[model samples]
Target: MAKQLLAVAEQKARQMGLACDIAIVDAGANLVAFHRMDHARIAGIEIAKGKAWTSVAMQMPTANLAQSALPGGPTYGINTTNQGRLTVLGGGIPLVRDGMIVGGIGVSGGTSAQDIEVATAAVQAFAAAHTHHSTGASRTIR
Candidate 1:
């Protein structure tokens, strides 16, 4: 699963002509697979991982997190409280299968929306692959 996610992400990154740092994290927010494009910023790797970890750990889109972490939101302190492991910015998305979150994908070193687009593409690719191999049916992962 980790390899599949990484492959799809890497492919998308290449196709989009964007250098990126991609990370895949398990449900526990542990790193499973990671890749840094040849020209990507070294720092983006960790940031991407942290964003993905935040998504899986919080079970919400990173964009939503960004909103919640605004100046006066309930989770404003989250940015400083999670040991810098949580990022409220965009680029992270949880991967769900069979109504269960399997892991997450994060992309960094690009615009926020670009990061989200790549990560979302990876998730969609994974879903399509899984569906193609299972009972000739398809399922949507929320």
Candidate 2:
């Protein structure tokens, strides 16, 4: 599953002409697999991992936290609680199957939108691999 996720993200990154860092984490938020495309930003290595970790830890897409993490929002400063490892960015997505979170995927080294697109493709691939339904049709995916 991790390998498939990495392959899907890598393909998306290549399609967008981006060199990206991709990370996959299991349900426990442990790193399962990772890939750094040639010339990917050095800073993206940890950021990608952090994004995956944050998605699993928080049980939601990291993009959902962006606005709430802002000052005066419900989750303001929440990013500071996880030893500064939490990232309220758009690149992380939770992998869900049968209404349960199975893992997470994170991408970096592109614009937030591009990163989100790549991660989303990976999640869609995971969904397709596990079910017969159309990809990205899962309610747990957001």
Candidate 3:
């Protein structure tokens, strides 16, 4: 599943003409798989991984954290609490299967919106695959 998710994300990045880094983390926020596209920024590797970790740790889309991470927001200094591992970027998304957050996916090396777009594609692929194989539980990506 990790490899499949990476493939789907890379395909989307190719379609968008982006060179990016993608990372996946398990429910415990541990690295599952990662890919760095040709010409992708070196820094994006860590950022991608961080995004995935942040999503799983927070159990929410990283984009949503951006708001609360702002000055004077509820989580204004949340980023500073995790050894600076948390990022309020838009590319991270939680992968929920059977109503449980099973993992997370993250993309970097493009604009926030573009990263989000690519990650979303991966999530959609995951959902489709789940739907094709099983029929009972709900799946969500956010």
Query: What would the TM-score be for candidate 2 when compared with the true structure?
Result: 0.91
- Residue range 1-142, candidate 3, lDDT tens digits: 8998999999999999999999999999999999999999999999999999999999999999989999999999999988999989899999988889999998998999999999999999888878766864544323
Q: Candidate 3, 67: how far from true, in Å?
A: 1.4
Give one digit per residue, the lDDT tens place, for model 2 in 7-92.
98999999999999999999999999999999999999999999999999999999999889999999999988968999998899
Q: Which window of ten consecutive residues has the lowest lDDT sum in model 3?
A: 133-142
Top candidate on TM-score is 3
Q: Work out how many backbone clashes candidate 1 has.
A: 0
Q: In candidate 3, which residue pairs clash?
A: none
**Lowest summed-lDDT stretch of 10 residues in model 1?**
133-142
Cand. 1 Cα-lDDT: 0.85
Ranking by lDDT: 3, 2, 1
- Regarding lDDT, does 2 or 3 come out ahead? 3
- Candidate 1 versus the native: TM-score? 0.89
Candidate 2 Cα outliers beyond 4 Å, as residue runs: 132-142
Per-model lDDT: 0.85, 0.91, 0.92
- Top lDDT model: 3
Pitting candidate 1 against candidate 3, the one with the higher TM-score is 3
